[model samples]
Target: MDSEPPAAGIDVSKPHPARRYDYWLGGKNNFPADRASADVVAEAFPTIRLAALENRSFLRRAVDYLAEAGVRQFLDIGTGLPTAGNVHEIAQSIAPESRVVYVDNDPIVLLHARELLDSSPEGATAYLDADVRDPADILRKLDESRMLDLDRPVALMLVAIMHFITDDASPYELVRTLCDALPSGSYLVMSHATSDHMSAEELADTNAANQRSGVPFRLRTTEEFARFFTGLDLVSPGVGSVMAWRPGEWRPHPRPEAVAMLGAVARIP
Candidate 1:
């Protein structure tokens, strides 16, 4: 890809979800193993690549909206391998004083963060090597970094990552814990894959293929995805297909529902 070797301790032998996603986005950071796995998924559902692009576009629009609303700090959990229009870039471009903290357990992502996620002089950016399931650890890392002010309003981004967490892990509870830790005015930006539109056979085939690829995929319903924002005020055009929320001509997906991803932005009151 970039001529840079895989970061130390990175397992290149197995296909990682982040790398597979990068492959779907037409990025060159993925290996043959990831491409092979992605090929299987593409064959099963030809729209997966489109779904990835739609989710990314949703991320950009959501961040832009948040920035316009005067939210200057961001806590992006499950921040996968960095791609275009990252949180810091979008936020800082709008307000140079914006501060962003990215969290992910992948060493390779951390290795590349310094190079790709640079911040403006007036703003700051930091990365946390932690998992989404461990809210306390994430908070502790944020506390240690002091990169963001907890008392101030921060946008907690859970985009395209929560689906990886199975129900047994108490994904809902985990999200509640993270949202609870934020201030009253903080916002929650989330996007998740769903089985609501997929047929039983399609779900079965996709799950089986994902299992073989080593990436845990759990497709939640729209209601289940909405539970993460319980007791919060949803932004306009709430909880719909990712491409339908504030759709712009930037990256148009004619049939967003076909992408099978639901997204929304809400504020914790």
Candidate 2:
């Protein structure tokens, strides 16, 4: 894949979660450091690559479902390196007038934002350099951009990125802050990594590997993952594995547990 010059202050010496994730997704936008860190995690949990692919699949399905449901606006936070079936692409394909805003703090992702995420003629797509932990900043930037109307319903997507936000960061409150800002008809589409399906030995090994890679991975339980949907009306198929979230004929992974990612979609009633 072609790339522009590294943005100033972008330290490629250390592995970043987004780049490591790109490596796992079989993308060529990763560096040696990212490959090494991804390798460490793969050694512990061989299914990590599958999990990443499945996570992308879940994102596409969620976007398609929301678009079909008549939610024309989307706010995708912590959107990593651009891949196929992006939020705007899927939504605009179904609804030409759909609008989407992609947010991420990574300099590399920001540098390639325009090149990878192209908008439809009738719709709009904007990229924001912001952190997920700071919802106020994100909301302010979105409002300033005028890409989305807060008064109308929007689908807030948080897929496979929440695990990086540890307990001390008050992730639940952060999520609530963003969701609370949207209208009652808004939706929350999320997918989180979990250890609930792993054996004790596997969980310990995976945690140790992630720790060694210098990336924080706080795997949650199924029940803990369900807490993210609190105060929202969960759609059918409640919280379940990523592979089982309205799976289509496009199978990305062989087994559900191999993905180890839980997903759910809910509406703000």
Candidate 3:
């Protein structure tokens, strides 16, 4: 794992969700602080790593589904480290003309933005250094770049990132603001962390770990998680474990309780 060199405004002494997630996914782009924080959560919830991996798989499946359904543009917010099977890669594989814009506020992600810029010859990909909480700026940049057209349908990828936005941050409205910018046929694919699948003891341990996790995290219940899709039309088998959502031929996905992340896809009518 190559440690990240210090960049302006980035403190390696504290853990960040993207780096923590990278550690969970067996990636080499993380620091000791991230590893320590991740270990704390893993100690409390043994399936934390599985949940990260399964959430990633859900992203791939959702991209596959949207590509086959004829969506050619993707606006992926909270874009973490670029790994294999990224949004444009999956979409372009099926439809070579897909265009994707990846957004993230983390300086480290911006440093590696080049990894995500490798677009297919027929498609286009761009990385934006912005925060999801500021939907206005994101849209402004998108409009300026013309990388994606708001007049057309796009798949909004919010996978595993919402949980980091605490309730005080108005997470639901933040999501709605983004969804509202898209055309009617656009889709929102999301996966959020939840305590619904945990035992009482497990919940306590995780809650404790979260206090020192170096970020604001809210593990909502199934009902709470569903609120983000309030005005949208949910796809079939909506709001269940990511591991269980359209597992396809991989029928016997690991137990939902073990993968404690709720995944769903909703179409804007």
Which structure among the candidates has the greatest TM-score?
A: 3
Superior by TM-score: candidate 2 or candidate 3: 3
Q: What's the lDDT for all of these models?
A: 0.87, 0.89, 0.90
Error of 3 at 227 (Å): 0.8
Model 3 TM-score on a 0 to 1 scale: 0.96
User: Could you report the Cα RMSD, in angstroms, for every candidate shown?
Assistant: 1.7, 1.7, 1.3
lDDT of 3: 0.90
Off by over 4 Å in 3: 2-4, 7-9
TM-score: model 1 vs. ground truth:
0.95
* TM-score versus the correct structure, for each prediction: 0.95, 0.95, 0.96
Model 1 error, position 217 (Å)? 1.0
Local error of candidate 1 at 226, Å?
A: 1.2
Better of 2 and 3 by lDDT: 3
lDDT of 2 by residue, 50-108 (tens): 88988898899999999999999999998888887888889999999999999999888
lDDT string for model 1 (1-269, tens) is 54256766888778877888888988877777788888887877788998998899899999999999999999999888888899899999999999999998877788778854589999989888999989989999899999889899999999999999988899999999998989989999999998887788988988887777667778899988888888999999999999889986664356755699999999999
Arranged by TM-score, best first? 3, 2, 1
The candidate that achieves the highest lDDT relative to the unseen native structure: 3
